[model samples]
Target: MRTVRIENLPNRSQMHELYHGRGSLGANRMKKILVVRIGALGDAIHALPMVNELHRREPESEIYWAAGPSVVSFLKGHSALSGFITVNKGVKGLFNAAKLVRKKFDCAIDTQGLIKSAFIAASSSNMVIGRAWNSVREKPASFFYTEKVEPQKEHIIEQNLELLEPLFPNETKFEIKYDIPIHEHPEWKFLSETPILFNIGGGWWTKLWERENFVQLANRIDKVLGLPVGIVWGPGEEDNAKYIAAHSSAQLAPPTLFRDLAGIFSKARLLVSGETGPLHLAVAVGCRTIALLGPTAGTRNGPYGKEQITIEPQLPCRPCHSRTCADFRCMPMITPDRVFNEIANKLER
Candidate 1:
């Protein structure tokens, strides 16, 4: 096993190896490709643009995604993707990879670049492209990839996009797009009229701003703009959603499916959320978004799109990306007045 640390984007020679022509002899003849990015919901959503680019570059090639069970539902009805293979994150996941190897994909791209993802890519095929595993926290996984694509930036979306640069050489002509099919549901009828929707939960506790702050912001929006605010929550976040709804003048939307959530977000005037799946989803569908960042840096995992706004307080220790925060002060430092003022300015423009 070899470890390579990629601090910056790959140089021309490295890019040539990773993307230009296919590698040595038989590698160029491969017709089927597997893209593996199995992780947090937001990261999974970010991977869509790259997947779309791959489909465009190789229209006839079968592009299958190896992802976790949680992301399967999002990819279920996508037209650009061939299918998804579920990989559990532990010992059983290795067995799952061995099963996939029997199907025999010609090439695999491990977008996640973790040990588990690398193992799956290694088990499945010989032609693999991914970030050097050593560059990640898990070092031993680098053995899985045949080619290492070092992107120029820290932003995950940009990194994922750079992975496909080899397949398409012309930079200006390559347009990245994610087509999320809208499912018509009467349950989301209220959203058709409501212009603003706010998402209140994410995987990290530290990322969530104070609930009272959200209520105050909602109240201000309702009073100033007269726009109805719809609150969105994931499976385990109903209680928090209810609390926000109870205290604020905003309306509570029914629980939304991942696919349908895109539609709701698309129709909204603006979306306010912490770093979460819905924020990224909203950006994908071209909705205006206001995101609050605490431990996470907006530069890396911020919302992607033209109409997005992010609020992050400046603290020396901020963006520690810690799962737990010793000081809750970082998030509390962001006030309703600052957020509401930004929202007011955005809506006015």
Candidate 2:
């Protein structure tokens, strides 16, 4: 007996070929598009290049972003974005966001790859584009997508751009760049003159380098480079920032928002930090970085710039991706001496 064979559906490129002009929903034809990449600061920053390219390619299309309350301020004033749909905390906020987005766009792209973000995309538009089941952070997130794209790139920024394959089917290359606006904070303007900076906090404990290491690094910079070092911190991190400055030549910087932080990154000669939002922000603004990666690998989440340096530990359990660890040895292994030499070499060059 002969058995009937079943085949899988066409991929993105094949679909494009079959539907190029006949009712194709490419970016060229879309009147409105929604990009759903809600918070965490670093992920939001990574989506910038994708948003910028969408605007660049389809200037007439109204590009909107659905962002979390914390990053709403950062996403605002983007030259490409038409407006924002802020997603506040709690169930009421989600319902309100869903209501506000209902039937509002021709397409919605869920770059966040979380279930909540995918739900936002599904509610916002008829055509939902998202990462494939295996590619997304949450497997369930892919279920809501009408078009599922599996990314071919390693970096988070490049992975985000891969979501646009449906929109720009003919294009293979994209400019992985960010045009982040820099509004110098009046109080933190002194940071522009500071040559070296250290971000003393990474939200996850596993991602944070030792405070004592920062102190040692700062003293080394002062002794050899003769360059002033400054400490940059966010909320709930002031005490640690002060501790580093008090023990060494580093000075504490004023509290500043993303725009102001961008201003500092635009001018600072170098920044030392573990994998965190600020580390990615520095890369976005073209600052040199010595990224101390422990629970995360440099190849995937590290700075995108070729000149940027990422120092990973030699430990076997280095990239455990753990939020909490019994013995967190990776960050400590990246010694102050290693970081200092990188900074000195880069400056000398």
lDDT leader: 2
lDDT tens readout by residue for model 2, 172-271: 8888768888876567655656679898889899898889999999999999889989888998899888899889988888888756788888778889
Off by over 4 Å in 2: 1-28, 186-189
Would you list the clashing residue pairs of candidate 1? 19-166, 195-269
Clashes per model (N, Cα, C within 3 A):
2, 0
lDDT of all predictions: 0.76, 0.83
Task: Spell out the clash pairs found in candidate 2.
Answer: none
Error of 2 at 53 (Å): 0.5
Q: What overall lDDT, based on C-alpha atoms, would model 2 receive against the true structure?
A: 0.83
Deviation (Å) of 234 in candidate 2: 0.9
The sequence of per-residue lDDT tens digits that candidate 1 reaches over residues 90-142 is 78776765576533566678888778887777666656677765455467777
Candidate 1 — worst ten consecutive residues by lDDT sum?
1-10
User: What TM-score does model 1 achieve against the real structure?
Assistant: 0.89
